[model samples]
Every structure is written in C-alpha cells, then in structure tokens.
Target: MKFLIAIALLSLSSCAVHHHHHYPDAPQTSAEPEYGNTDELYADEQDYVDDDEEPDSPAVAYPEDMPEEEAEPTTHQPEYPQYEPEETRTANQPKVPSVLQNCDVENFETGWIVAKCGSAELFVQTGPAARGSYYELSNFAATYATMVTNQETAYWGKRSAISVNGARGESTEYQFRAMKPGLFGGGTVDKDGEIIAHGIFTTAKTQHGKAGMLCLTYGSADKASCQRYFNALGKDLKELGRKNGPVMVGGVALRSEGKCHFLRPRELACSNGSLTWQGGSRQALENLVETTIAKWTDDHGIAGFYNPHLVTKCTIAGQTSTCHEVRFQGVMSTPAEIRHATLLEHQSLAVMCTYSTQESAPPPCTKFFGKS
Candidate 1:
C-alpha cells in the first residue's frame, strides 16, 4: 500500500510539470529582422500594422514651424497686332490744266494775236513802241476787240485783256519783228495816214522796272479761223510770263499829277517836281551793283534795274514845285542782295507814301498802289 501510494504521487507530480511546460500562457517577443532582408516577415507584419493595431514602425514627428512646399505655376504668352506702310506722292509729277484744249484762240491779226481761254488773257506783239502810242492804238481796237470777239465766240470763256505793245527799234524788235510766227497788229493811221505795224508782244513788268516781251507767232491770218491758234498762243504766253525772262531797261521815271500817276520805264525829261534819291553812299551803291551783276552771271539769271525814278513821285508844296523823283542804280549783286533790294524797295515805299491824315505820321509807300 505504501509503495503504490508513493508511485501515484510521483506520477502526478511529473504530469503537472509536463502540463505547465507545454501549455505556458506568458507574452512572446519576435526576433529582430536583418537590415533589409525580411520580405516575408515585413509582408506578414503588414496585416498586423492596421485595424487599430499599434504601429511597430519608429515614430516620425513634423515640426510645427516648418513651411510647406509650393506648386509651380503655368506660363502664358500674349499676341500683338500687325502694322502696314502708308502711301506717298513722288516729286517729278506734272500738273495738268483744268480747261479743255479745244477753245483756246479768240482772234488773230498782223503782228498781234489775242487769245482767251479759262482765266487767261494773251496779247502778243512784235516790237518796242512808246507806251502811250502803243496803248492808244492796240489796247482799244486790236487787243480789246480781239479779246471781245474771242469771248463772244467761245461757249464758256471769261476774258481779261493783257495789253502787249511794241516799238520798231530795241531788243523787242529783234525778238518780235525778227520772228514772224506770232500775233501781229498794225497801229491806227498816224496824222500822216500811213498804216505802220505797231509794237508787237506782251509785256511782263518786273519789280526792277524792266519789261519782258512775250511773243506768240502761231496763229491764223483771218481772225475768224484763229480760235485754236489763239488758245495755243495764250497758253504759251502764260507760261512765258511765269518764267519772267531777263529784260534790259534803258531808263525809268515816276510822275504824278494830283491822282493821275504814271510809271515811265525809259528816262524822260520831267516837266514838274523836285527829286530826292536814297539807297546808300555812292561807293556802297556801286559795290552792291557790282555784286548783283556777279551773282546774276553765276546763276545765269536777269538782274532788276531799280529806277527809283519809275517808282516814286512827290509834288512840292509850292504851286510851281517840281515833282520829286528818286533813283538807285546797280550793275551786279548776289541773288540774296537782289532779293533784299526788292524787299527794301517795297518797305521803303511804305514809309515814303502817305495814306492817312495823322500829323506827325508818314503814310506807307505801298498805299500808293491802292492796297495791292
């Protein structure tokens, strides 16, 4: 009985020790993974990493003061409008006349041709003549009548008479009489009743008191058939006047009686008035004249003859007082001096002439021309 009981106690004790060792219920720890070599372990651990399970990874905390990175912005481009060039006119273009070419001539005569078309008046003559004698014969009967006849014939012609007078001798004679292809006119019978070809061309009076002769030779013999011929002559004469060729003035003088005033191109003996001349000292005047001549030669242009005698005339206060005249003469000068002389003459006239009644004031010289 004692041996059996002892055996049972030993068996019981062994069984209890075996059961405790095999069924231990305490927590277990996993082995540390090698540096980068636990693919299976890491993948399996992924399942235990979530679903409210405490993470096994090391804690990573961000700083409260650190700034966040900013995203890059997209770029954009802009477009602009295109520009174009403008048109311009060239300098060499010619200007055409407005009037028709058909109705040009009005009348034709010996040594004279009268033409009217548009706003132009053309009087063509042949030689130099006394101003009074030329005007008396030509202005009334030949030029005036021809102009009137031409206007009457044309459908829409407005006429102005440009008187052309010529004398038998002088540069005009060589220019007009020598050339027969222009307008022609005969002076009225003189006291002797002889018909003579009067002076022949148109005249362009220069600022220097010289006259330019304009000649027109292309025209018809019978005044009635010379319409086209007259027109051509008129056009040519207008162009010539604009060109203003050089003129040789033999002399010039101015005279006035009351309101009647006359400008004389050739020096003539004056029956009345005293004379006063102003320009510069004799030596200075001579120098200016030489200078003007030199410039004219260089430019191949004409120089003006300033005949104070032809521009101004003043009556003396006394009843028998002679008319006062002034004169300035120069042979050569620069173009600038020529221009200056022209301007000076124009201004001088203004100061010398009287138009107003102010006691201490002198009237402007330009006033004598009745306001241009």
Candidate 2:
C-alpha cells in the first residue's frame, strides 16, 4: 500500500508542472487597431480624391501657446507707355513757303544774281572776308550812288543798321540808296522811314571763316516782299559760308559828313569815333598819341588826356591788341569829364578816339573790345 501511494503523488506533481508551462491569455486584444484610428498608413497607395469631393477631416485648431506661421511675400511690376520722336514729327510737317525751300540751291550764286522767285526778287553776292560787324557792300553802293546821283549817299551810322534772325543764323542788315530811283523802290518806304530808291544788304560770316552778302531793293508799295526775299538770300549765304572758307571783302568805303575814308583789312574807322592805325614801334605810337592828345587839349584850353588804365585785350586782324581808358578833364565841369578807349598793338597800333559824357567809354570803344 505504501508503494502505490508514492506513484500517485508523482503523477499529480507532473500534471501541475504542465499546467504552469501554458501562456496567460493576451490582454483583451481585437482585430481592429488601438485608439480607434481609421487613417491610411501609406497615403501614396490611396486613390486620389476629386477636387469637388468633401475632405475627410476637419481643420484642427492650434493651441494658444503655439507660434503662428507667416505668409510668403509677393512682388509686383510696373508698366510704361511710349511716344513718337520729335525729329520724325518735324520731318512730316509742311513748309510755309515752298519757293524759299530751293532758293539755297536753285538761286544760289557766287557773285551777284537776281533770282525772281514767284512774286519775289532776290539779289545775292558771296565774298571773301572774316565776318565783321560793318556792311562793306553798302559802302560801295553808297559810293556809286554818290557819284551817279550826286546826292549824299553816306551811310547813316547805326541808325541804318538792323539785326535780323534768319533761318540759318544771324545777319547784319544795312540800308542804302540805290542808284536808280526805281531800282528797288517804286515809291516804297524802307524800315528806317526812308521813301527813296532804298535797298537792303545783308551780311554774315560763315562758321568756316568765309563771308557772304545778300541784297534786295524795295520794288513796290509793300516792303514785306523785299524783307522776305532778303531773309531768304541771307539764310542761303549763311549756309554757304559754312562750306566756303574765307574770301575777299568786296568793297568798303565810309563817307561821313563830307569826308570819305577808305579802309583796308584790320582797319576800322568813322568820323569823330575812328580806328586810326599807325605803323611804328609800340613806344613810338604811345608817345605820338599822348603828344597829340596833350597838344589838342592845350590848344582848346582844356586839361590833357592822362592816366591810362587798361580795360581789356582783344584780337584784331589775327593780332593781339591792348585797350586802355584814357581820362581827360571836362571843358567846364567835373560831370563833363571824359574817358575814351585807345588800343595799342606791338607791331601796329590802332587808336580809337571817341567823345562821350558817360563815366565809361562809348560803344565804339566797348564794341571793338568785345565788351558788347
């Protein structure tokens, strides 16, 4: 009986060990995932949704402490408008007078040529001389008129001069009497209130250093036609002077009061206010001018000219000249004290004598000195 009881106890112990070897039941696991998540693990594998379809999830709100994202900056550009050029517009514009257009080419002449443009008569001449303020051709005309008509054909100074702005450039215009009574005037008055056989001569210096002249006569009661023709020729001459270099000064003869003075290049003169030249050493010329002024003042019972103060320096005839203001006591009072400009050059001296009451010298002195 003791042996049977030991065998039963051994069997019961083996059965208990076998039961302990089995695993405990996994804690409540289901086939679905935890936290009830239904989102796809691999989004690329899912089918694309149409734009019209509603989204599966609603927008999430950020926490109060979470930072907000900033939007990206965008750039904008500007647009501009364009217009036509000025030169192109000017080229398309119409000319006021067609006849004046071709006058430079068709009616152009080196010497005197009378161009009869529709209802206009133009007289033109081109000469050689560096541009000067004086009108040389008018001097010749005045001389010829004086000899032929026996009338005083002297130039009437600055009063007979006019400044004209032509199509090309500036022109110096001079008024003079034509030889024939009906030459340029059929009883027409000129700009200077002169109702004789009067005409105009326009002069200009080209950029190329040449000189040109254009002349026209008042042929009718209306002076507009004459002025128009004169301007046309002047414009042509200015253009021509640009191409043609220096040329001759056709003719120059100055007649003042009853005296006539013929001039050469680099020499300028007039009655009372004159540019007299002396060929001598500078010292000799100065001495001569001083002596003459002193003697004249002494003879006239007036204080002599003294105390030369240099005014400025200028070029005349390609030579440099020094100008001075020489003061003299007035004949009667201090207000009458006079000052004049005298020019002295190294090789040749050009003396300008002018009489004026102003503290400064007259136009002849200032004009020649380039002050004007």
Candidate 3:
C-alpha cells in the first residue's frame, strides 16, 4: 500500500510541474489607444509656404465632417409697467356748490300748531324758533292764524275774543276774533255773543306760536337753557294740541338777527334726536338734499325726512312775495324713495311736509329787516 501511495504522489507532483510550465505567461495581447491626441500628426501644405503665400496664425479648423449648431439671439422684456391713479378733479370741471348743512329740529325750540281741517285733512304746522330770540313768537302767531283761516268754508272756523300779551310791541292786552268755526264741536255761536271756543282756541294758538319763539330766545342763551325750554314747551304744546293725532305739518324758520333776508321755512320732523326732509326730483338735486339731511340727522340727534310726493321750494325774502301761494313740491315716489321712507319710518317717527317758497321778496333796506 505504501509503494502504491508513493507512485500516486510522484505522478501528482509531475502533473503540477507540467501544468505550471505549460501556462507560459498567458500569451501577451496589445493595449487599446487613448481618446484625444496631444501632438500634431500631419503637417499642412501652408506650413511649408514661403513669403509669397500668406502666413497662417494657429488656425482653429473645425471638422468639416461634423454637424454644425446655430446660436439663437435672446430678447429681454420687463415683467411689470408703472401706472398713475386718475385724478377726480379736472381743470375744466365745474366746481359743485356747497349745500346748506342740515339742522336738528329737535335741537331747536319746537312747537306744533295743528287745526283739524276734518278727519281726512288735518292742517299741522310745527314751527322751530331760533335759540334765544323773541321774533319767533310773532312767526308762531302769524303762522297759526294763517293756517286757521286758509281752509275752505266747509272747514272754516272763527276766533273769539281772548286776552293777548307781548303781541306787536311790549306786553299789551288785546282781544282776538275767530275767522272760522271750531272743528272741536260746540260750534255755531250766536252772532251777538262772543264764541266760547275762542278762549281755548286763541290760547292754544297763541301758546303754540309763542312756545317756538320763547324756545328760540331761551335756547340761544345756552344749550342747557334751550333743552329746558324745549322740554317745557314740548309739554305745554303737546297738552294744548293733544286733540291732533300723530300726523302733523312741521315748519322751520331760520331767522338771522344780522340780516333781513327771509328764507323759506323748511319742514323737519323730530323724534328720537333725529330730523329729516324730502327733496324735489328736478335734477340729481334730490339726492343732494336727501344725503345732506341724512348726514345731518346722523351726526346730530335729529332724524331724516322722506316723502315721494313732497317737493322743496326756495324764495329769498326780497326775491318773491307770494310765499303762501307757492305750493311745496318734492321728489316723486320712486323705488329708492319709497325704500328710504320705509327705513325712516321703521327707524323712528318722521315729520314730513311740503317745502314752500315765498313769492314776495323782502326789500333789501336793512340787513336785519325781515330776516330775524
């Protein structure tokens, strides 16, 4: 067995030695060439040219066999542009006139003089006097007397004798006569005897008119005084004119002690610290009046006015004489006007009346003639 093992080992060693000798460094193969060349391989015909031929500076010859690419030009544009705001005012534009500012009816000394013309037609005239001015008293009396007599014969009423003080001049005693019959019943007085209704009627008429004048005088002195006077007058007038219901005509007289011009009385209804009025529809003028009154009502305690049928009329004291003849006209009812009316009524009680202008103009004799 040992002899056989020795023969096998000798055979394996001879086989390993023969295998190593047969490898022979694995038959050598050549390597591949590099991508880019560092030196020039061929000389050009121009390189050999003499002075007669132009000498070439290191010519960068592009390969004629390769494809060519073109360069494109670029354009730049701004992302945003600047602009200016439009001006509201223009050189050729007509300047708008500033309208009169709204006045608070409640702020003034207010009094209502109402006469029942009948159930369907009741005449109401509320007068507002300037603060601390006695002139309004005369206005109240005149207006009350005028309203009472202006009605048709059917609604006509007469005034009876009643004592009046502080009338034309200083306090004086005077008797008042009714121009028509009383609407409060107990009518038809005998021609020989003085009417019983005159006492109460004249007292109410005078008191209603006087309250406005007194309020103006007292109110002008101070705001507190005005407020007190207004409260008192309101209580008194309300008590005296209690027969008249919710609806009443209201008037406002702007009397300037320094000037004689007479301005038409404006209608302003007062409730809950607000005053308002309706305007005519001739032009966009109606909007101006509405907005003006609204702004006044909003800023002050006064409310605003709205009525489609009511129109506003203006007459300077000297410009016209037919003050009572000019019927007050206002804007016709439109959807917007109706809407405003609804809002005003819903928000608070609004006093509404037609705005009338006087026909006769006051003579421009003195600045204080007819104004105050």
Best-fitting candidate, scored by TM-score: 2
- For residues 19-106, write the lDDT of model 3, one tens digit per residue: 0000001001011111100111112222110111111101011112323223112221122111111121122222211210122121
**What is the lDDT of every predicted structure here?**
0.21, 0.30, 0.21
lDDT of 2 by residue, 1-372 (tens): 110001111122112100000111111111111110000112122221111111110111111232222311211112111111223323443332344565433221112233434433344333312222222333333222222222322222111333444434333233343222334322211223332333444444333232333443333333455555555444444333222222111111111111112222222222223333333445655666555444334433435433333455656445566555444444443423233334345334434444334334333334444432
Displacement of residue 372 (Cα, Å) in model 2 is: 20
Give the per-residue lDDT digits (tens) of candidate 1, residues 185-251: 2111112221122223323332212222322222322222223333343344432211211111111
lDDT of 3 at 162: 25
Which segments of candidate 3 are over 4 A away from where they belong?
A: 1-136, 142-169, 180-343, 356-372
Q: Which has the higher TM-score value, candidate number 2 or candidate number 3?
A: 2
- Candidate 1: list runs displaced more than 4 Å: 1-121, 124-176, 179-216, 219-222, 225-340, 344-372
When summed lDDT is taken over every stretch of 10 residues in candidate 1, the lowest stretch is: 32-41
- The superposed Cα distance between candidate 2 and the true structure at residue 253, in angstroms, equals 27
Compute each candidate's TM-score over C-alphas: 0.19, 0.26, 0.21
**Model 2, stretches more than 4 Å misplaced?**
1-199, 203-330, 335-345, 353-357, 361-372
